[model samples]
Target chain A: MVSAMICLLKMPCAVVCSKIAKRGGAAWISTLAYSLAVYAGAPDVDQIFSARWAAGIDDGRSQLFELGWRPEARWRFNDGGRLTGRLRLRVQTESGTRPGNIENDSFAPATRPQTIGETGELDLRELYYERPLDDWYLTIGKQQVVWGKADGLKVLDVVNPQSFREFILEDFEQSRIPLWTFNAERSIDDWLGGDWTLQLLWIPDQTYHALPKQNATYAFSSPRLAPQPPPGVSALIRSSEKPDRLFADSDAGMRLSGFVSGWDVSINYLYQYDNRPALHQRFISGATPLVEITPRYHRMHVLGGTFSHAIGDWVIRGELGYFSGRYFLSNASQAQDGVASSPELSVVIGLDWSGVEDMFISVQWFESWLSDYRQGFTRPERDNSLSLLTRRYFWNDTLQAELLWIANTHDNDGLLRPSLSYELEDNLEVRAGLDIFYGKRAGLFGQFDNNDRFYISLRYGL
Target chain B: MKIQQLFGMGVLLMLICEAVWSTPLPDADEIARRINARDEGVAVARSLTMRLTDRRGKTRTRETRAFRKYYGKEKRTVIFYLKPANVRNTAFLTWDYPQADKDDDQWLYLPAMRKVRRISASDRGDYFLGTDLTYEDIKLETRVSMNDYRRKTTGEDEVDGHHCYLLESIPVDEDTARELGYGRVEQCVDSEIWMVRRSRFWDIKGKPLKTSYFRDIRKVQGIWTQHRIEVENHKSGHRTLFLFRDVDYEHGVSDDLFTQNALRRGL
Candidate 1:
C-alpha cells in the first residue's frame, strides 16, 4: 500500500517534468529533482538513493524510517497451504572512528567524524510458509530471529546476529527469528497459557555498521603474509585469502520463544548458533578484518529471558542471558574456547515511575560477564553500565522536555548527558543536547576525547 | 397432568433464580451517551499545575495549558508550556479521532532553533507537558465502556449538591492498561448533568494506585463542564491539578492553528 501511493505520486511528476522540457533550465532542474525523489523512494531495488518517507519512527534517541509492500510478501495462504517470501536490499554510508589520522593515532579523541564507510547489501531477508491449525501454528522458512527483551541502550540483543553495533533498525529490529525449519505454537486456556514459538534458521555471516575504532573487521596493506608459500605461490595466493575479508560462515541454528505467566514473562532462547567472528577478529586471525559483531569462535549457543512486574506506580523489568561457543575479538577474528566451560552471561534491571500522566523518571542498570572476553574490551563502554533519565512538562502545552544521566562501570568511566527539546508545531521539532563525561571516555562514551559538542537535529514529517 | 404440572414448577423456579443473579442493568445507554457527550464540540483552554513528590518527598512544580477543539472527524489539541527554563516556549499539535484507535497525530514546534517535528506512537509514553501523563492519556475513552450504571446505596450523601452516578470504567485493551496503568477506574459524575466528580484507578490485580477528582461542574453554553481535575498519586501523595479556565465551546478553531506556522507564532 505504501509503495503504490508512492508510485502514483511519481507518475504525475514524470509527465509534468517531461512536458516542461521546452522551458529549458527550469524544466531540467525539475526533472532532476523529480528523478532524485524517485531514486530515494526506490529502496526496494536498493537504488543509489532512497526516499526518506519514513513518516519516521521517533525512538527516544533518533527518528528512523521505512516504506512498503516492503521487505516484500513472498507468500499467501490457501485452503491447504500458505506461501511467503521477502527480498531485502540496502546500501549504507557511514563515518566511523575518528582521530585515526597520522596526527592522532594512539590517543583516542572525544569525538571524531572520520569513521566513514559504506556497504551494499542484498539478501532474501525473509522467506517463509506457515500451515496453521485451530490450536497450533507451524512456520518454516529462512527467517531472522530477534531475541531482545531489555529496553536496552547496549547489549542483550541476543537473537539473530546482525550488525550488533552502530546504526541499525531499532524498533521491529527484534521482530523476526527465522530459519529453514518448521515450528509450532499452541494457545490454551489454563492456569498458565501462552504461545510457544519454535524455529530453526541457518544464521548468516555477522557484520557491523559504522562504529569508529570498533567492530571486528580489519583492513591492512602489508603485501607479505604466511600460508602463501612465498613468492612462488603469489599467483595461487589470490585464492588463499584477502586482506579485508573475515573468515566466517553462517550456520544453521534453532530458536524458541514465548510468553508465560499470563502475558507477563517473555522467554527467549536460542541454541546451536554458528558463531562467526567480527571483521576485526577475522582480519587479526586470518589476515583480514571481519564485519560487525562477528564472533571469534565457530560454534556457540545462547539462552535468555526477560520479565516485568508492576509494583504499584513502579514497573520493574529485567533481562538475562548466557552465551557459549567461539568468542573472538580484533580486526582479524581469532577463536576462543570451543566449549561451554567459559561462557558469558549478562543481566539488566530497570524501574519506571509510570503512574504520572505526562512526566516520568526511570533508572536502569546492567552487568555483563565474559570470563574469557576474547580481545574483550575492558573499556568502560564495553563493560558494565547504568543510566537514569527524568522528564517533565511546564507552562501548559507549549513545551515538551527531557533529562538523562548515564553512569558506566560505577561512574568511574561514564557520562552525565542532558538534553532539551521544543516543539514549534506539528511538522517541525528542534533539539539540542550535551554530553559531559568524566574519567576515561571513548567509543560512544565520548564524542571528542575530553571535549564536548552540542548535538542538534530538526525534522519535519508529512 | 401430574407430570406436566411438576415440570412447570421446576421451570418457574429456574426463572426466579435467573432473575436474582442477572445484574439489573440501568439506563446504561443514557450513561454512555452522557460520557460521550461532553466537549463534543468545544474550544477549550485549560491551565494545568503539576506538583511531584519523588520517592524522597522533594517537590517540583510545573505549569502548562492545552488549547483544544473538536470538529467533525477531528479533535485538534495544542499544548503550550507556561513556566520553567529551556522549555519556556514550546507547542505541540495533535489531530486525534482520525481513523484508528484514537490515534494522535502529534507535532512539536521548538523556538530554540526554530523548528517543528512529529512524534511517534512508541514514544507517546515518554512525556507530555513535562508531567506523568503520556500522549496516550490525552486521547480519551480508550474503550472505557459502561458495565451497569446504578444508583449508589448512599446517594443522599452529596458532596456538592446534585446526586452523582457512580460508574465503573473497565478497560478492555492494553492501550488503556498501559495508559491508566490500572486494572479499573471507578468514577462518579452528577446523575442529573453527567459532569464528572471524582475517580479512583486500580491496577489489573486490583491494587489501589491513583485517585483523581474533577470538580466545579458548571454549564457553559448549555454544556456541562468540569473546570477542575485533580490527579493524586495514591502511593506518593503527589498531585497535579488541571483547571479549565476561560473555556468556550463551538468557537471554531482554525485549521491554521494546528500548523507549524502558527506554533512559531507563540503566546
Candidate 2:
C-alpha cells in the first residue's frame, strides 16, 4: 500500500488509473489509484471565494468631478492555477475649460478611449492567469510589473508606460498602462550560497505613452511635455508612428535577484522601444517658414540593478540605470533634425525610517545625467530631483495621515500632496486631500499651478 | 480474598505516595528551556482567521493561510492574506535565526505594487496587521526567547482543569524592556504538556497592557497545536481573536515558498 501511494504521488493517479482500467487491470489497484487521485487533486474547499466591488465619488474645488466603480473577481483551480480580473467604470465632468492639448490618441491605438462616451468610460483594467509548473511560476495576460525600489519616482521601473491624464497626480497603479506579458520566475536555493530568483519577461503589447485629451482638466500646456512654437514659426505636428507588428516589436527583459549578506539585490536588463515619441523635424524655408514635426518611436536598451538593506528600523534602497539610444527634443541648428540621441544614466536612493511610534518617514534623491551633452536640448545635461514622504496612523490604525512632496531641483518646481483617510468601517473609507503645485512657469510642476485643487472622496467596498 | 484485596490497595496507595513525594519539580529555567524546545512538527501549514474588535464594539475580520518550516537551526515562515479586498494577496515572509544577536530578515509583498519590499524587524513590538498582538508575540508563539528575560517560578494555579506552574519573567535590562515594550510578563505553563496556556504583559512603565489566552489545544500528527488564541488590551478596551484550523504537519511545503519570489506569487 505504501509503494502504491508513492507511485500515485509521482504522476496524476487518475490518468494512470483510467489507462489501467482500459487494459483490464486488477480492481483493487484501479480503486486505490482513483481514490488517491481524488484526494490529492481536490481543491481547498474550505477557502473563501469572494468578489470585491468598490464604488467611489470624488469632488474637487476646481470643479473636477469623478464617480468610479471597480469590480474584481478571483478564481482558483484544482490544478493550482489562479485567474483574476478587474473592470473599471468612471464618469468624469469638468466645469471649467482647459487649454492647450493634442488630438485624442494622436500617438497609438492603445491610447484611444475604450468606450464610446463623451463623459463616461467603461474599461477592463486587468485580467491575468497565474500558474505554477514544476519549479517555474508563470503569469500571463494584461498586468503591471514594478521593478524598482524608489518611492514616488522612476529609475529602473520603466517596464510599463504611463498615462499623464492626471499629470502625476494619480497613483501609478491607476496611471500605468498595463500590457500583455508573459512572465516566468524560478528560484535557485544554493547559488553562491545565497537564495536567488531569475525572472524573464516578454511583452508584446504595443501600447505607447498616453497624453490627456483636449479641454481635459489636466491637459499639458508646458513647453517640455507639449509643443510650444517659437515666434513667427508656424509648426505642423504630424501624428506619431508606432510599431504595429506584434511579436516582431515585442519587448524582452531578464532579471536575476538574490539575497546575500542581509541585502536584497537584483540585476535587470531590458530591450524595448521608448515609451515617448521622438520629434523628427523638416524645416521648410522661403515664403513663410514652416517646421514640420514628425513624431516617431525609437528602440532603446536599459541595464540597471536595485539593492536594499534594512538596519535597525531603517531601510535603504537604491536603483541605478544605464540607458542607450535615448532621444531628446532639440532646437540646435546643426542639421535641423529637431532630435538628438544620447546615452543617459539615472539613479535614485531612498531611505525609510519607522522608528517613531506610529509614524513612517521616507526621503529620496534622484538624478538623471545625459552623457553626450548637447547645448540646445530642451533639458539640461544633468537633472536632479528630490522627494519626501511622511505618513502616520492614529486611533488604532483606523485613521491615516500622509504627505508627499516631489521637487525638481533644476526647474525649482514641485508638487505637494497631503491627504487624510478614516476608515468608517472595515470596507468603507472617507478621504480628503489637496494637490498643490508651485514654482517657474516653464518648469514641470509650475506649469500646473493653475490646476491646484482640494478634493474629497468616499469609497465603500463589498 | 478481602484480606488480599486490602493488602493490594495499601500497596498501591503507598506507591502513589512515593511517586508524589520523591519526584522534584523542574526549575524555572529548565521549564523555560523545555517550552522553547518543545517538539513542534518540522513543517506545518494551517488556516488562520483573525477578528479584531475595537473599543466601540465594531469588529473586522481577516483570513489567511500560514506556513512554517525549520531549516536546521533557523526557521522560516510565510503568511498569505486570503480575505478582505483591501488586503487580499498581501503576504509577509520572515527568516528567523536562533541566535539572539542576529536580526531576523523580513519582507512584505503588496499585490497592488507587484514588488517585494524588505522591512526592518527591529520594530517587532508594533502591533501586527492592526491586531492586538504585536509582531514579537506572533513570532514567539511556537518558541520562547530564553535569552531576553530573567525567569522565576512564582506559584501554582489551576486553569481549565489543568495544573499550571506560574512564572514571572522580568526583562534583563532597561534597553531590552524598552525594545520589547514590556517591563514584565507573567505566564501560566501547563505542567503536563509544557505549553504556555496564558500570558499577561505590563508596559514599559509597569502598567497593565494586555493578556493572551491559549485554548483548545489538541495533538495532530503527533504534535501538540493550539487551535485558538485571544488577546485583550486592558487600557484600550480592544480585543483580537485568532482561530486556527485544518492544520497539517506533513504538507512537505517547498523551500521556495519562503523566498521573495514565492511571496509575490500568491498561493
Candidate 3:
C-alpha cells in the first residue's frame, strides 16, 4: 500500500518534469532537485471532502446545501523554485422557501451548472511555477497575488478579480480568480539600504469578475439591464464587446516595497481595464419605446500604498488607493448614452492587539470618497465602514472561537460572523459558523439579510 | 633571637595566603559569554521532529528542516515545515543582531495565504505551534548575554553522572519578567562543555511551571549538541519532545535563504 501510494504521488511530478524537459529551457539539475523535494516534503496525497448545510433564520425552511472536494500538490526545487497545482469541485443545492419562484431568481443561471445531482464543473484553482534568480524572483502561469494587509477590505488588493457567486460568504482565498501573468521581483536592498524589493507584473489573460447569474442564489437586484425587445418593435441590436486578446490589451503593474524603522511599506501602480462592464444605452426612432444596451470594458489607473508598523504589543496597518477614470452607472433620471467616469479615493487603517493571553483583537476603519461628486452616479459621494475581529484560543490552541463584525457606517447596514473551529487531529478539523446580516434592503449587507444562515464544515487533510 | 625569627616566618606565611585568595573566580556574565561562544560555527543544518503530547495523552508530530548561517556579526536562521499536509511548505526566517537593544527581524510565510508576513518581536513569548517551547527558548541557545537577565551561580549539580554548574537567572525588572511569563529560571550547565543539560522555569507566583531536560549529548563537527530535548508543563499535563537528526555543520548555505522572498518560496 505504501509503495502504491508513493508511486501514485510520483506520477504527477514525473509527468510534469518530462513535459518541461521536452519543452526544453529547464535545467535537468533543477528538475531533479524539484522532484526530490516533492518526494521528501509532499504528502502522498492530500484530499479534503466537505459538506455544509445552512438555513435562513427568518424562514427555517429556506436552506442551502453544498458538497466540495479539493486536491492539491506542491513541489520545490533548489535555489528557491516551486510549483503548485490545485483542483476544486463543488456541488450546491438550494431550496427556495421565500415568496419568489426559483425560476424567476436572477442568480439561478449561475448556479445551474453546479446544481444538485449534476456533474459539477472542475476548477483549476492554482497552476503556477516560481523561480528565484540571483537577486530576482519570477513566477509565471495562473496564480493569485495578494497585495494588501488590511483586514476585510480591498484597498490595494485589486490584482485579481473576484467571484461573487456566493456573495461575501466565501473566503477570499477561494473567491479570488487567478490570472495568467508574468510576475518578477528584484531586491534593491544593497542600494536602498533597507530590505527593499521591486516587483513587476504583466497579465496577458484579461479575466473579468464572475458575477452571480440572474436568478441564482445570492444574486442582488441591480438597475443595469440588457433587455431583449419584443419582436414587433424595430430596435438596433448591440452585443457586449470584450477586449481582444493582444499585448495592448494586457494589464501592467509595478510595486516597490521595503522595511524601514520597524515599518513595512509598499507603493504600487496598476494600469488595467475594469473587470465589470459599463452599460451603454441607445434609443431607436420609433413610436414604441425601444432601447439597446451594450456592455463594454473601460480603462482605469490605480495608485496605492500600504504600511504596517509594530508599536509595543500592537500592530498598526493602513492602506490607501487613488483610482482615476473609474466608470459608474448613471442615475435613472439621466438620459446618458453611457456610464460616467469619476475619480475616487479609498483608505483603510487598522490595529491588531494581543495584550491578553490567548486572545487577539483587530479593528479597522475604511472610507471611500469620490473626488468630483454629481447627482447622476450610482454610489454616494462618500462612504464609511468599520470592521472588528476578535479571536480566542483554547485547549492548547487546538480550539479557536472568532467573532467578526463589519458595519457600513453610512448605510447603517452590517454583517456579523461568529465561528468556532476545533482541530480533531493533526490532519482533521471541524468548523461551524453563523452569518447574520442587518439593516436596509438596498444596502450591501442588508440585501443578504434574508440569506442569513448557519453552517458547519468538516475537513480532513492528508 | 630564635623567637624573633619564628614570628617573621608566620607573617610571611600569612602574606602568601592573602595573595592566593585575592584571585577572583569568573563572574556570571563571563560564564554566560563563554557558554555562548562554545558552539560557534560558520553554518549548520538539521532536520528535527517534534512530538507533542496533550493532557489527554493525544500526540501530534511535526517535522522541519532548519538552516542557520552567520554573516559578519549578524546571524540568520530559517526553518521550513516538511510534514503534515496542512502545514507543508510553511517557512519562518529570522535575523538576529549583535546589538542587544535591537529587536530581531522575523517573518513568516504561510502557504495558504501565499504571502510573507512580518511578525512582531513580542511574539517570542508565545508557545511555538502548541509545543512546550517558545520562540525565546529557541533563541536562548545563542543569545546568552545578560543584558536583560540577572544571573548568579547558585552552586553545583550533577546530571546523568556529569558535574554541572547550577545557575539562577531572573529578569532585570518585573515588567520584563511578566512579559517573558517567567519569574525565574534555573539552568544546569555542563561545566566542561558549557552546554545546558536541564532547566526549570517558575511562574510569576514563584511556583514551578515547567522543566526541560536535554538528553543524548553528542559531538557533531566539533560542537557539543543535545540530540534530544523534552519539556514538560507542570500546570498542564502536557509535554513535548524534540529530536534532532541529520545534523551537519560547516554546510555552505546561501545568504539568499534567509531573505523574506526565500521564505515565501519555501527554499
TM-scores, each model vs. reference: 0.44, 0.86, 0.84
Question: How well does candidate 2 score on lDDT at residue A38?
Answer: 52
- Give the CA lDDT, 0 to 100, for residue B21 in model 3: 79
Model 3 lDDT tens row, B149-193: 899888788998888888889989887777677889898888888
lDDT of 1 by residue, B1-267 (tens): 799999999999999998988655445456556666655445666565555444445445555666777677567778776444334457877766555443345557664433343344334444354344445555552113332122232222244666666666666676656654666766666666665566677765788867777777777777677677667666645555565676666565554455444464444
TM-score of chain B of 3: 0.88
Q: C-alpha displacement of A382 in model 2, angstroms?
A: 1.5
Question: How well is each residue in A188-263 modelled by candidate 3, as lDDT tens digits?
Answer: 8888887898999998766666665445567654332223334675444354566766588888999999888878
| Runs of candidate 1 exceeding 4 Å displacement | A1-146, A160-263, A272-297, A326-341, A371-383, A393-399, A441-451, B1-267
TM-score of chain A of 2: 0.83
Better of 2 and 3 by DockQ: 3
* Candidate 2: segments with Cα more than 4 A from true spot: A1-63, A95-113, A190-193, A232-236, A281-292, B1-25
**DockQ (0 to 1) for model 2:** 0.31
lDDT of 2 at A2: 71
True contacts kept of each: 0.06, 0.49, 0.33
lDDT of 2 by residue, B1-267 (tens): 699999999999999998888755568898898897888878889999999899899988889999999999798999999777667779989998888889999999987677888888877877777788877787777566788899999888877788998889999998788778789999999998999999999999999999999999999998889999999999888899999999999878787779887787777
- Cα lDDT of model 2 by residue, A328-365, tens digit: 87777773687888899999999999886677899999
Which candidate wins on TM-score? Answer: 2
Sorted by lDDT, highest first, which candidate order results? 2, 3, 1
Predictions in order: lDDT? 0.47, 0.78, 0.75
Q: Indicate the residue-level lDDT of A424 in model 2.
A: 78
